[model samples]
Target: MTDHPYNEMPRSDDNQSLFRPVAVGGRGLPGNLALAPMAGATDGVFRAICREQGASLTCTELVSARGIRHDPGWARSWRYLAITPAEQPVAIQLFGADPDDFDYAVRAVLEHPVLSSAFAIDINMVCPVPKVVGTGAGSALMRDLPLAARVIRSAVAAASGYEVPVTVKFRTGWDAATADTPAFARMAEQSGAAMLMVHARTRDMMYAGQADWSVIARVKAAVSVPVFGNGDVRDGPSAVAMLRETGADGAAIGRGALGNPWVFAHAAAALRGEAPLPPPDVAARAQTALREVRERAANLGEARGVRESRKSLLWYLHGTPRAAETRRRAAVVESLKEVERLLADWESSFFDKNGAVHFT
Candidate 1:
């Protein structure tokens, strides 16, 4: 449906394999490619970078239900809470299981001026992280359909007087043998979710094996609301295949966009019937990384901002020609000057000769 061009495009009913602007809170979201709410990764600065590079929608890292109540300033103080004016339509994701706690979490989120202005409220019901599931939230919700539905309904009620749309992200159930994405999708839609995001993997997998796109297809078949497939979408072709193979409404990219913010833009272009553009060259990527640090530091203070950004720098340089050496240098980088020095020397070898990224 979207005109973006990938290496291989699949044909289907016009309604079935296309990119349509999803409207939340009566606003039209641009690209079909949405960023996943990866914990400690999808912070506000990173979200802005990806959005600038062309992500249609972005989500905040998962926040705890209890954390919000305990720390009234949690959302306000989080680096991800500092969104730029341009990255509108982003969603803040929250995780928790207790019905009362869930309600309290919603109230906390609504208190933030920036958060309440979001296009949608995303409920994270599918995170596979042990710390998250251990508390009966995240993937643990898969085992209790009734409770999960209640949580969703409670969140929806919090927005009763508002127009903000409610969306849910979930996995393929607790395990491979017991995949229940279809059932969950039905429950989410029936309970009031305007959108459903399927991660295509089970809680047990936990980033192990490849995501089962077939499961995504099944969820899409079972749900009338838009179904965005997530998992293993590290490139334009993969994004295209996920759409084709699963007939998903869109994609929710996570690790893939870490070092490669261009993924969002390239994927958007590919989806729009154009040849994919290459990622920035080493020099350009390094410059972008530096700019990101500066921007984040400006907003979050220098010391903590640069320190919090170390992992992302390593991600961008991962798999470059001299990645091992680059990673070695990045790991030891304690200051912005050190980061700049490392990228200065490694730029030539790590970046493509012609400045095109080859994710292959």
Candidate 2:
């Protein structure tokens, strides 16, 4: 273990806000680490947790542009775009193929009450999920450059009169084995993308195998906008390595932060050349799990939060002893009391040869 465990606490507001700020679309985000928007996760409460932990900014789960245009009241899509003051500098990411629908979605966001806090808007072009891909959206856009350009154009036009910065998050190409990501990155810039986040994988590759950082470097060299590298950035050193290796501007944390938001906290410190805090102990994990559940419950209400937080509660114990057994019990928990009991017991059993959740 490194001699310095990041145990850093809240510094003054002015100090934290200015620490290695990242520039996105002419605006400075508070830090360099951003939480990658997960489809089922990354709600308001979750976003807040990541920010509190040290992530400078975060994206909303991919909201469907077509769905929003078709039914503005669709709870699943538009509702995810919810932003708050504490989560300022948040970007709401949109997906879907219809350029007209994307226009509609952008207008809707600008007109919403939350418009004032909407930091930036991001377009999703890299998701490998089949349902999204089937819609000619997500990674499918990588293959259809013309349509991708059109949708991006629409988003840019819609936000043109406003101060909101428009961005894109996409994949390397349709094929991982033969990626032409640099061209795509240039296209995104020409199409008015103020910043770009590239998941260094191809469409066919899905989430398997390693992310190609070389593509990220190529993209960075080709574009003037800020480039945030995605895929395989699991911790501080890797985050730093991505920036160093690719010459990219920032690192967006995805599955690496599932159970450990501290990855963001540590990443913030690492980016600023400071020591990161130690990994959370078992007790910290249990408390955070409970706090997240309650916060989710508060934001999404009782039923939804309880249902949604179940997976997260289990995720919090990823490398703990008897994790497999506890994960099973966590899945079917009927009440908050049961969740409390399970986590409380798990907290008591934190002892292992090493203190961290992972042994590898």
Candidate 3:
């Protein structure tokens, strides 16, 4: 609602005219709101929802560069790279530090004809999880600037024949005490990265304290490529606040979009000076949950998807009226049919008179 420098940017449509794109690469990205590459959470199905909800840009979950090279099954993991024509301008995110391995992975992604339609391919250098960094991939690459720069230059060169731009997503640093976000962002820009996404927290923070918008602002100031400020953007107003405060060209939404993909549309609307709506009603919420579950099941298959979806299903139900009770009921669901049955019976009671999730 507040008109600030960040809120002042014109909202552009999807690739229609010469209007500046959201500036993902050296050019505009078309859609300003981007979906962050959450490991298990940002799969193809969920990405479809966020795209439908008005996210102009979306990224695949972080894929291992090493896996993409060593394992034939690696292509299977790239299932998240599956994109329909509707969701154009998607970015497939990859991780790993080995220059040779990264070169191979870049070639692998480019070989797929379907992936050519993407706006760009992003390298992830900002994951904090031990499993990822322990392999010297993800945010670990940040500590080794020479290797990180080499990876980007090499990936870009390998994918040079293709038109898709190459970008990087990274953290502030390992921790607050050793923050290198400002310096590294500049380095990536210098090394030919098309765009830079600053998560605004050091790896150590790991979604802990508030995302340092100031650092995001600093990165934006330091880099010429469009800098997308991420973290703590849980709703429309927060998106506006970050945009205004940091003057970032765009925002990358993560955990906030967990059970609420509508955030993309709402954020787009708010940036254009529109009113934000309340969270969806119980029926709508249930429908969304059902769709998400069904899609996950379809992608991952019923048995595995059902089991893997349990935690997300719980996240979707969080803060709903009788959510605890409903989740308790949902916990026993052993199959897709059971999940649907439980949701059907309990949808109505989830919304209170005030139109919020009921606690009881």
Count of backbone clashes, every candidate in sequence:
13, 3, 9
Per-model TM against the reference: 0.89, 0.89, 0.89
Clashes of 1: 13
How should the candidates be ordered by lDDT, best one leading? 2, 3, 1
**269: Cα error in model 1, Å:** 1.9
TM-score of 2: 0.89
Q: Worst ten-residue run, lDDT, model 1? A: 1-10
Model 3 residue pairs with clashes: 21-28, 22-29, 22-30, 23-28, 23-29, 320-358, 321-357, 321-358, 322-360
* Candidate 3 lDDT over residue span 106-158, tens digit each: 88878877776667889999988999899888988888999999999988887
For model 1, the superposed segments whose C-alpha errors exceed 4 Å read: 1-17, 24-26, 75-77, 80-82, 348-360
lDDT of the structure predicted as candidate 2: 0.80
In candidate 2 the C-alpha lDDT for residue 356 amounts to 44
Least lDDT summed over 10 consecutive residues: which range in candidate 2?
A: 1-10
